[model samples]
Target: MLSSLAAGFGLGLSLIVAIGAQNLFVLRQGVRREHVLSVVAVCAVSDAVLIALGVSGIGAVVTAVPWLLDVVRWAGAAFLVGYGMLAARRALRPTGAALHVETEAPPAERGGRTMVATTTRTAAVLTCLALTWLNPHVYLDTVFLLGSVAATHGAERGVFGVGAAAASLVWFAALGYGARFLGRWLDSPGAWRVLDGVIALVMWGLAFSLVLPVFTG
Candidate 1:
């Protein structure tokens, strides 16, 4: 059990450490103090669902459908590339105020009289789901990849899978909440620009790493 747990935790941590759109979204939300933990919670829960599905023999179904993997590969690659472009564009844009006070929009102009601030919460949830689900790489990693390794342990695979899920819950919570403490620094336009620029570079680099092998092959 202990060994299985260790394997699971290590597997989970390794994947979560990588910089991706989801982490970038979480980082920005943390800085904004906008339902940050909720974002983290959704990500963790989504991962847990996928991990559970993988552990419960759904991996065989995924493995059987090579087309599914291919579709995911292409979609994930495209999404990563697109997100990288957007990040680079944002980085090049002039820095703006860190926080903007909410303004009341005129009734007809508001489109159904919805508060902009309320809409941000919905956007956050949708973005979290899109980040988690749209990236076929995530399915490959959490399901196909981890699933294969966990299978080696036979009956102990369940224990291992649980450990990995726990890691996701803990890591994202820590990353999302712990990062908020840096909000003071992030409030500075120069600091935000530098941090976001670094993030953009890292995101683009990861995207290249994902798609480069296809051309090289």
Candidate 2:
């Protein structure tokens, strides 16, 4: 049981540590200090739920319906493309002023631009949800891959799933909270432009990868 748990934790962390759209969004939010807790909770909880489904043998059902992934693949690609365009726009037309990190400033004092760097809690949460749920690779990694690995543990699969879920929580918490330290560096518009530019490239790259398989396969 201990060995299975350890394996699950290690594998889970490895899968999630990759540079992906969801991770990039979380990092951006963390650096902006905008809805960090909500974003982290959504990501971590969503991973746990998906991991639970996989361990419960739902992966078999998902596999049985190949069309389900097809639909998800197209939708994910579309969403990613749209998001990438938005990021590109931000990068190309950067706000001249540095991002305002001091949240205590009055709306008037902040040049009446409270909405510039920060977003509402609802928007933040919804974006986080879309980024998490709309990515087909997430299902492949957490549900199918992780589930298949857990099955090898036999009766200890449950413990393995728990370990995997725990890893998700730990990773997201550290990533979301730890990114605040980079806030000082992202204070300049040029820095923000570079970050958004990188985000746009990654988003479009993921989108293209998602669709390329359909045409190539």
Candidate 3:
């Protein structure tokens, strides 16, 4: 049981440790200190739900629907590409003030910057939801792959799922909160540009990967 728990935790951590859209968004929000708690909660909860579904054998049913995966693949690819373009634009023309702000400032003092600085809680939460649910990779990794692996654990699979969910909580909490350390450095517009550039790359790269599988398969 101990071994199975460890294995599940390890597997879950390894899968999520990769640089992906969700991780990047968490880091971005963290740097800006905008809706950090909500974003973290949404991501962790989403992962827990997906992991539960996988362990419940819903993944098999999901994979059986090839057309569904195909549709999600294209939709996800389109969303990523559009978002990547926006990130690339931000990289090209970034304003540090627009990306960062201390909430203590009065709205009038914030001026036009207020509009940019105030990434509404609604927008942030919705974006977080879209990123979590729209990414086909999330489904593949959490549902199909993880679910299939959990099946191998037989009676101990529930324990494995618990361990995996715990890992998700730990990772997101660390990432969403720990990003503040870099906030000072990213105070410079140049640093934000660099970060945005990297985000654009990751988004487009994942988008391409999603599309490639369709053509290749």
- The local distance difference test score of each candidate is 0.75, 0.89, 0.85
Cα lDDT tens digits, model 2, 158-185, are 9999999999999999999899778678
Candidate 1 has its poorest 10 consecutive residues by lDDT at 107-116
Clashing pairs in 2: none
lDDT of 3 by residue, 26-81 (tens): 99988777789999999999999999999999987876788998888888889889
Q: Give the per-residue Cα lDDT of candidate 1 at 101.
A: 19
User: Each candidate's root-mean-square deviation in Å?
Assistant: 6.0, 2.7, 3.1
> How many clashes in candidate 3?
0
- Mind giving the per-residue lDDT tens digits that candidate 1 earns over 1-217? 9999999999988988877878887877765567886899899999999888888879899778877766666666666666666666666774344442122434223334332232277888987887788777788788888788888989999998998899898888888877767756664556756776776777667666666767896
In model 2, where do residues sit more than 4 Å from their true spots? 100-116
Q: Number of clashing residue pairs in every model?
A: 0, 0, 0
TM-score of 2: 0.92
What would the TM-score be for candidate 3 when compared with the true structure? 0.89
